[model samples]
Target: MDTSAPVRILTVCTGNICRSPVAERLLQAGLDQAVPGGFEVASAGTRAMVGEPMQPISADIVRTFGGSPDHFAARQLTPNILRGVDLVLTMTSGHRGEVLQLDASLLKRTFTIREFARMLDVLDQRAADGVAEAGAAVVPSTADAHDGASPLAANAAYWRGLPARAAGVRHLSLPADSSENDIVDPYRRDPGVYRQMEDQLAPAIVSILRHARLNAPSAEAAAGPGS
Candidate 1:
């Protein structure tokens, strides 16, 4: 697990003014509470929505969730932005393609927000299987006595085995039912639709927060009571 720097996340959409900004704010609020300075979340649009404030309907929905949308403004997605981010989480599949086209290297790091959440779910399962295997094979106090291997070495072996077990998961592709999990675009839609979108986004943001906690090395370390 890399703990070298803060996790930089960029959320994207067709126009930053609406869906992307709302998703950004939701993610920011969750991260501010859960991870603090350990991660960053920002949003942009594939087309130019630069300098625009979030739509009034989106703002209302944000307010209902007790979040202030003041800090976010629309911006255009650019190669530089995608290049700088550790994760590019887009609002839709089309938005995902746009970010990848900007930089193909981003394919490894980019995912639709819900898509990444699902990947995190897969990773969590892998980690659990690792812990269980370690517990079963290595008697904690005796691991260092039988072999010349240190307890740390035994632990490293367990960790090393995880990636191979998780190789079967398709990280880049979301299932066909992903639409039910996605934050439906509310651009030019009624305020009711905006509210519905916010509802979908808020839960996905929470799931992403949980996933980051489970995976981020810095987050795991800071999780200690006095740290």
Candidate 2:
């Protein structure tokens, strides 16, 4: 892609009616709040319940997180959908594998939601350290930087840069165990299971939005005068 186009992020799950839609809404809401219009979030299922709405409990959880669950119909995953998406976040390692089976080249941009969250934590620390090392060099003068690049645009560029960064550090062990990286499917389970899914998804959404905000042009402008 076109960097000028909105960064598209896709969330994948088995049926699309539960985990993926919930994650999709939550991420969109969070990103909207953090950096309005910075990204677009959509969801699909490897084996989709096509045209179905999200599970009632899943919608409730989304509402609890202040996300709207309206008009959400399940979609089937396809290589075409994957082709345009900037990032793919899956509910489980199995889902990630399914996505990769569709398009093997997506390996770099595809990650389990928890895995990406953990990676974001690492990236944030590295960014902080980079700023410190360069003696507050994180914020470049907006005038000297790319013309007409808004903070959201700058953040979008940073978002695009993640795959390369991830590739460079692929050899390093992740901080969490691989087993802990998956968000278990809560379909037809009790309310508590749905809550568990919410617990897992919410923070990861926050982390991603937070990182995007940090790279936004507004953030750079806010930091400019003081330095």
Top candidate (TM-score): 2
Cα deviation at 189, candidate 2, in Å, is 1.3
| Cα displacement (Å) at residue 153, model 1 | 22
Among residues 3 or more apart in sequence or in different chains, the pairs in candidate 2 whose N, CA or C atoms overlap within 3 Å are 151-216, 151-217
Candidate 2 lDDT over residue span 1-227, tens digit each: 55545678999999999999988998899888766777899999999999999999999888988999999999999999898788999999999999999999988899999878876767677767763222223434222335556665555665676655644544452745777788978998988888788888888888877776665557455334534
lDDT of 2: 0.79
- lDDT tens digits, residues 1-227, model 1? 44334557788888788777777777777666654555567888899578888888878766776667896668888888876576677888888888888899876666677766665566567657764423434432212222443333333333233233333355433577857546687888777887788777776776666754554333223233343
Which residue pairs come into collision in candidate 1?
A: none
Highest lDDT scorer: 2
C-alpha displacement of 68 in model 2, angstroms?
0.2
Lowest lDDT sum, 10 consecutive residues, model 2, at: 133-142
